[model samples]
Target: MTLLSDQMPCRYVPILAIRPAEMKALEELPEVDKDSMLPLILIRPWLSANTLSKSINRFKEAYGETRPWLADIDPFYAAALANDDDDDDEADPKKVFSEIEALQDPANGYSNWCAFIEADPRAIPCLRLDPNNINALTQEIITFSAMQRGICLRIPRAGFGGIGQIADILNAQNVTSVLFILDFEQATMNELSNAAAAIGLINTIKGKIPGAEIAISATTFPDSFNGLKEQAIAERGFFSLIKAQLGQFRLIYSDRGSARAEKRTGGGGLPPPRVDYPSFKNWYFFKPEKIPTYQAAAKAAMTHKSWEPKMKIWGTQMIERTAKGDPYAIVSPVRSTATRINLHLHHQLYFDDPPLALQEIEDDWVD
Candidate 1:
């Protein structure tokens, strides 16, 4: 019943068409979405705000906590934001990890979005700092501190066409486990190659961090996932490239979809919604969950049972950074998913029809 096995403990599955303005939608999730144990979709900010943290908090407080967006599973992931990449002289992830912890001490409060639940059986509370203004040490320190506290860090490797500074943060953090996200909209043949080319990019720097598990995630595009398709069909030779060069069995971006993934419209909305390319239109790279047996049986209703996966795996070496910067991110105001931090969510749904026929039970069900 294992859909996939990778270094990271779970696969974060995202939902698509998440608007920044409508991020408050998180507050009204049904039982499933609110269940901290299940995977979640991130609704990012419409436009990168200078005060990203405050804006999101205000929205959530005004609305409500839609899902358990703030719970921690066995491992924790705290993501950070940065924009000035390819500067070469950036603080590492470890430094960023430290910086955030110091700021969140209740005395500093400089970490505009810093907050710790201070509860066990808790998923770490991630800080989505100001992408444009966050310091070099911000991400590095957060990663380091969170991991020391037994939390995994989820850092956005904003692929804005560069050998991003986030890599240094990733290297600096060097925790035992971490989650990395890339945007398909920003993904490029070069960035993917250069990123992997940077050794310890996939695995944490040696002697710096140990037992770190890496997972790559991306946002899906409107219609094409050809990059991933080639990788899956090819058994993802690019991932092999990372294992050979980067030396990690981590899940690459395409495995989760497009990292610099663009925005598209889903067909419906609300407690019951329909999406275009529903299967692959997730917004973020989420840890996957166990499907309920009944839910698994319900796959029959899916538009297409089979997907000719269009995923790409890129583990290339370093190169140039783009002018726009590669650190775009959006966090829902909700604290955590109902299923989080060591609490695995397994549910059952009944599908009357699926994208593929192999799952059909009886003709009556299909008709």
Candidate 2:
């Protein structure tokens, strides 16, 4: 199910976000039907505004005629779940709710509702999760609500866009959208090959989800190494293996440098001599598009899900990489020449012994 296997190239070109009547075009898509779909129903859990039945009815009415994607797609709303002041701007409590209201028209039926029931009873999920719960669900009525609607779930972040938590949330909230994250192409030092391979792995994850978009740029950085290489042969070897095994891939260099670098020069305490590792600026993506092999690699990405995808990596740094996969900067005298490679591997561990109960998404919403 990679984006492009000889048999699995994606027919879907770009990812689209719809609201209200904008969904009309989706209705005509053959994939809308349950029988034709690999998976039916597109969950817009992020749409928390239309929580009230009246608003939801309007939301449905807005897109009632044209959209087939969410025919019965019910969103997961957590008004009781308060957010922190530092939360993403797009995720502002009031904005999330108001947008839902904007979609309301009072014509169609509610998308279905789920009241949050917490374990502590008094410590309701909404009360703890959403800061604007009162303002959002202020007039929510109890009696007319239906259990068939849902239990309004919470998807905890995992540093990397909350992968796999979507399904977990659905199970908790009794909803159906299997939203999850599949990170592909998180740039590593001297790991272009592995980055490419990671994209393939991501494609594989996406292939499993009918309407999923890959969760991209979740952990990407500002290219801390500035296109630096590694000194360890073992690390490069591992990257090779990763590249070979990747199912789908897309990458953007990031700056998650919690690691330090030192030179073995005359000045032991001082920073090492200048190294000339190639840079792969992601400012202008799509070199992969020009190369048939790279294009194939992109198509080979076995993506099964989709998240807000982007190129957090810059576009100017990368030059024609060597066969060995080292990114060479396209510049005179190599900006940081004679630079010996030292790679610091960053890992995303789900279980790291001490036991973790909470997760947080780190990136800011672009819009």
Candidate 3:
């Protein structure tokens, strides 16, 4: 079986939150998009332990194949699960460390966490470098490295100082095939500073490991769309800057797939109807104030100058169906979110090399 590490050089790496909307979006992706990227899924704590035990099957069903992908648990969510806390407050850091350590324990035999790595032999385990949990994280690296398949070490932008320690760990374990993810969650590009920092970090990693595959990721996607009609995808610009300095194939481009980097803590009542349309540079958001219904929003998106009538992706089709007064399409906020994400994924895949003849077809009627 070919390991996910061996399948290097994928175009994009989207860090997706594991939810119905996100999963549905992934399930509906075209074959070309599926083949072009390797998604790193973060398992949230919405499901019961029983359901989570069958997660690998769920992933296979959504993906339509046993293709290799990366898997990691949301630390805060896992910590809450470990302590059986029902509130939305952040769990204790010690509990989070313990929970992560427990997941790596082989003495307990098979566990739901183990299912993430064991059920699908192709699933690459993701390890976060935490100073509070350094020992546990190190042991996790060793254990996952023992699997012979490469492991992904996720280093947040702030954690760059620990790259030397990570290099030592890899060297001590004699693990060569590794994917280093420089995660800059919620951070946006500000001129060339962020890009320069990232370039320096990439250089440091290369100097340390010399053979480490690297991916730079972040999200400028806002947590709330209120008072915002458009937003620039700073991560894209950041990737462009780094690619210009280091060459195109030096690192992978990654993002949060148009979702917020930090998960919302509490449920805010239902969001106003909105449709986020991705263009080459920005996300043009449509939210009608006079009539705040999904159908109205979909109609606005359909009539917008940026709407691509020739684009046959599932998300666009959903918008078209909803605009035509199809009650079954985009009935609720969750479905709307799914539709947006589905479109976003397709957009990212074709961002650099757009399909020929994909120009917008003129509509017969005016909005």
* Top-lDDT structure, candidate number: 3
Residue 123 miss distance in model 1 (angstroms): 4.5
* Candidate 3 residue-wise lDDT, 1-367, digit = tens: 5465577878788888777778878888776678778898886533443344355455666675657788877655655555664454454333434444556454423243544576567688776455456566566666676677787877776688888777777777777788888888887545324577888888887877888899988888877677888878888888888888887557788887887777678876888878777765688788999998888888888888888888876788788888888888887878888888887877776677777225443433211
Give candidates' CA RMSD values in order: 15.8, 18.5, 5.5
TM per candidate: 0.38, 0.24, 0.84
Please give, for residues 1-367, the per-residue lDDT of candidate 2 as tens digits.
1111121111111111233211322222222221111111222332345344443344344234222221122222222232334556566545445434333322222212222221112111111112223223322212112222112212223223432333332333333322222222233445333455445444544454443333222123223333332232222333335435553443211111111111112533522222222122211111223343322222222121211123121111121222123434322112222110101110111112112102222323220
Give the runs in model 2 whose Cα sits over 4 Å from its true position. Answer: 1-21, 30-35, 38-113, 116-158, 161-179, 183-367
For residue 35, model 1's alpha carbon misses the true position, in angstroms, by: 8.1
Q: Using TM-score as the measure, what is the rank order of every candidate, best first?
A: 3, 1, 2
Give each model's whole-structure lDDT: 0.30, 0.25, 0.73
Model 3 RMSD in angstroms: 5.5
Minimal lDDT window, size 10, model 1:
313-322
The number of clashing residue pairs in each candidate reads 104, 73, 0
Return the lDDT, model 1, position 232: 23
After TM-score superposition, what is the CA distance of residue 22 in candidate 1 from its true location, in Å? 10
* Lowest summed lDDT window (length 10), candidate 2: 338-347
